[model samples]
Target: MRRRRGLTEEERELWSRVAASAQAMHPARPEMPAALTPPPREPVVAPKSLAKAFRVGEKARPRTGHDLAPPIGEGLAALPVVMDRKAHRNMVRGKLEPEAKLDLHGMTLAQAHPELIHFVLTAQDRGHRLILVITGKGKPGRDDDPVPQRMGVLRHQVPHWLRLPPLGAVVMQVTEAHLKHGGAGAYYIYLRRLR
Candidate 1:
C-alpha cells in the first residue's frame, strides 16, 4: 500500500490538543443579557418663557422699544441710488464730483462711529448736500460665518447713531451711495444745513 501524505505525529498531537481545548471552552451564544442594554437617552427641555414667547403664525408687533425715526427731515426717506464697482472708481477718481466724500478704510468700528458723526456734522455745517462715505467692501475673516459687524454695521448703525441727540439735527437722510461711491460699501449721507 502507498504511504498516505497526512499529519505527522507532532502535528496530530497539536491538532488533538486544540480540538480538546475548544470543546472544553464555553460555546458562543446569540443573545445578550438585559444588564448590558444601553442607558435611555434623556429628553431635552426648553425654558418656559422662551417656549411661550413666540408661537407659530403669531403676528409680530412693530418694535416700539426704541425710536425708529431718522435724525432729520421728518425721518428717513428713500432716494435714487446705484451700487457698482466701476461707478465707485469714477466717483473716487474725481471723474464724477459728488457733493462730499468720507473714506473709512483702516478705521475700526469704534473709531469710524465718532468720526462719521463729526464728519456729518461738519458737512451739514458746510452746507454740503450729498456726501459719500466709503466704508470699503467688507472682508470675510477666519470665522466660520461672516463678521456680524462689518461695513454693514456702519451702514445700519450710522442711521441709528445719527438719530441720537446732537447728530440728528444735521442728518436728514442716509442711503446706500450710487455706484459712483462704493455701492453697498459706501453711503450717501444727505444733510440739513444748520440754521
Candidate 2:
C-alpha cells in the first residue's frame, strides 16, 4: 500500500475554488410539505413478528399493518380451535377428506352470501362433519381503479359469515386447506354434530 499525504495549503485552496465555481448536475428540489409527502413505510415484516415455534394447525399472529384484511389462512388460524386436536392436525394437513365442498368463485357478494348459508345449513343437516368451500384466492391482477377496490371479497367474507348468525351456530371450525385440497384457494369448514 502507498503512504497517503494530506493536501498542501495551495492544493486545498485550488480545490475549494474549483468546487465553488462548478455547477450541480441536478438543481436542488424543494422539500415536499409533510402533508403531501408519503410517510416512511414500516418494515414489511420484522424478525420479532415471526412465531417462535411453528406447529401443524397453529394459529397465526398478525404480521403487518398494510393488509386490508388478514389473509384467509392467518384469519382462520386466529380463531379458537374448536375441533379435536388430532382431527385438526389431520384436517389442516389435508389428511381428513372433506365430506362435501362448495365453490363460490365467480360469484358476487350478493349471490354468494345466500348460497353459502344454504349450502352450509343443508350440509350440516345431512350430518357432514367437514366440507370444503372454494373462494379461489380472489382474482389476481393489476387493479388500476382510482377508487381503490379490494379484491377477494369472498375469501375474507366467508370466514366472517361462517362465524356469524345462522351459519355460525352450525359451523364448528374453519381452516385453510392444504395443497392437495386446493391450498390457499379453498377452506375446510368443520360443522357441528347434530344433537
lDDT of 1: 0.63
List per-candidate RMSD values in Å.
Answer: 17.8, 22.9
Residue pairs in candidate 2 whose N, alpha carbon or C atoms collide under 3 angstroms:
none
TM-score of 2: 0.62
Question: Lowest-scoring 10 consecutive residues by lDDT in candidate 2?
Answer: 61-70
Q: Per-candidate TM vs. native?
A: 0.46, 0.62
Residue pairs in clash, model 1:
82-179, 87-180
Per-model lDDT: 0.63, 0.85
- Report the number of the highest-TM-score candidate: 2
Question: Which lDDT tens digits does candidate 1 get at residues 1-195?
Answer: 999999899999999999887763677786878899888889999766744567765797753233234422133334332335465445434455557788888677889888987888778778886687787665543333433323234555665776686877776656555565566666666566567
